[model samples]
Target: MWYFLMSDAFTFGAFLISYGTIRFSVNHWADPNQVFNAFPFAGHANLPLAFVSLMTFILIFSSVTMVLAVHEGHKMNRKGVEKYMILTIIGGLAFLGCQAWEWTHMITGDHTVLVDGVLQTMGTTVTNNPWGVAADPGAITAALQKTPDANLAAIVHSLGHGGTADAHATLGRDQMISTIQAANLHVTTPGPIAFGGYFFGITGFHGFHVFSGVVINVIMYLKTKFGHFDQRGHYEMIEKAGLYWHFVDLVWVFVFLCFYLV
Candidate 1:
């Protein structure tokens, strides 16, 4: 915190300045509501946004458990540490699971009650949806809309932004690059540089930290039971892990703000 507040003005300040500058610059950036428009089981729930929000909540809950685990460890309460540690593990695992589901839905695509925003037609397409609704050609056609021309350029353009009539709703080449990568993640996998840029850059890095914290807590759990820290002998491990856990949660909070909420 001190480093950011005073020490490295050029390094940290440069980053903060850059982020703010870009944010200010995107006057026509995609609308969060429109970009995340989705349809879930109940018929096109706003899911992407919902998942991000849920992930945020899950991380926060995990933080609570992590803190409790550390507090108990400090008091030399092995059983208490064990309990809170278990809760922390469960929360971490749950977050990972949710992230897995979120990534899966993105690549496969999803259907929604939305239809061109204004049209609101119940369109469906295998190429478009994560679920690939019933094989009704009408629904698929209304959504997929393959290019009329057989040329690569046509296909590319049709999918590319500002393409032809057949490709209006399609993602452009540059935008579509990450589509495939999104399908293969364990938790928010990297999808091309754009998707991967944020995926691996932010979430992946955060996950790595989580992985390390889990390792520490697991050690703490075992030693705790074996009498190494029984009766609250060694609470330092928990405190250290808590610090790392808090950092992880803190990063997610920022991620939710910059990547999702904002």
Candidate 2:
């Protein structure tokens, strides 16, 4: 297992290093703060890094619980092992739920804006997001110029200060959609498509590890409940599962830093 983890480490490290190289080489990379600002039930309030911080804490705390479970297993305490393992499973599930919501938001995007008292709809293609380099007026204006018409120009005029002028502007998702549409343009993905490809691939791989750890924990919890460990006169299965769980948690710390915080 250790050897497997070492190999996995190299795989993820290669992806992250590639992401870093591409990010610095590009004219624009999406700001992590702007991209991950949304929070549940916050009504679109900008709460950058808060939710991911919570996710990180949950995973780390579950690692703590996993340690406790292992310690209890050393004492052959079935109840303690079951309890901590269950907590660890809950933590894993919560993290998965958070990831699901995040992916949904990212893919669907913020694509509706009220324009002149009318709500408008826009969508994200593989090539667009306000968080990208599209916040440059010159780029959007130049793009619009290629398809010049009175209507597109009017859209550009409305998007004037809101679209590209304020690079760090926290416009509503809907308003951003409107601006992108009016500009008749698509912003490049943060840095290059490779950045996103690595970001999603590495994170998704970690998430899968978390999910598998949860399943292993659940089975161990059930075994404890059914007296399987008691018959064997040992709870070492819990300890083994705990090692994997801790590994998942440790990997997440690196992931959060590379993909979210940094």
Candidate 3:
């Protein structure tokens, strides 16, 4: 396990180093603050890094529980090991849930951008970056001129208007276009295409590690429940599993720093 972890560390290190190189080479990269400034169930609230911080906390706490489980294993305390292992599994599952929501939010988000002298709505994806540099006032005005009435109305509705969908549907095209112009909604030029690739590749890789760790913990929990460790006269398996869990947590600290903080 130690050898495997060492090799894994080098892989992650190389990925991060390459990401940093590309990021610095670019004239404009997406701002983490603007990109991650969202919270679940909080409409349009700019809470940057809030959800990610919660995920970090949960993973770290799970590492603590894994340590406790290992300590108990040293003393052949089956019940203690079982309890801590269960907690660790729960934490891993919670982190996965949070990640799923974040991915869904990013992929499904409605962002307006100026493309080919016309305004179009898009979302973040491997080939698209919705969180690019904001378009200038002149560009926005020109794009608005070319924008279709239905697209204009969709943009206006995305700006959090209080009208019901039925009522909005009844409104005329001119009214919708006027509403959009009055609101002065900002659009962006697409960011570096590599940004989405790196973000998803690295974070998705880390999420897989977390998921693997959760599965290992679940198996460990079942083994403890069946008195497998007690029958063996030692709990080395639990200790080894704990080592893997801790390594997963440590890697996340760097992942969070690279993708979210730096």
Model 1, residue 63: displacement in angstroms?
0.9
User: lDDT: which is higher, 2 or 3?
Assistant: 3
Clashes of 3: 0
Off by over 4 Å in 3: 162-170
Superior by TM-score: candidate 2 or candidate 3: 3
Q: How far is candidate 2 from the true structure (C-alpha RMSD, Å)?
A: 7.8
Evaluate residue 3 in candidate 2 and report its C-alpha lDDT on the 0 to 100 scale: 77
Q: Which lDDT tens digits does candidate 1 get at residues 98-152?
A: 6666555444442222133111111112123212112333442333333222222
Task: Report the error of model 3 at residue 233, Å.
Answer: 1.4
Model 1, clash count? Answer: 12
- Which structure among the candidates has the greatest TM-score? 3
Give the TM-scores of the predictions, in the order they appear.
0.59, 0.74, 0.94
Off-target runs (Cα >4 Å) in candidate 1 are 1-27, 36-43, 110-196
The digit string of per-residue lDDT tens for model 3 on 8-77 reads: 9999899999999999999999888888888999989999999999999999999999999999999999
Candidate 1 TM-score, true structure as reference:
0.59
* Model 1: ten consecutive residues of lowest lDDT: 184-193
The residue-by-residue lDDT of candidate 2 on 48-87, one tens digit each, is: 9998999999999889988998888889888888888888
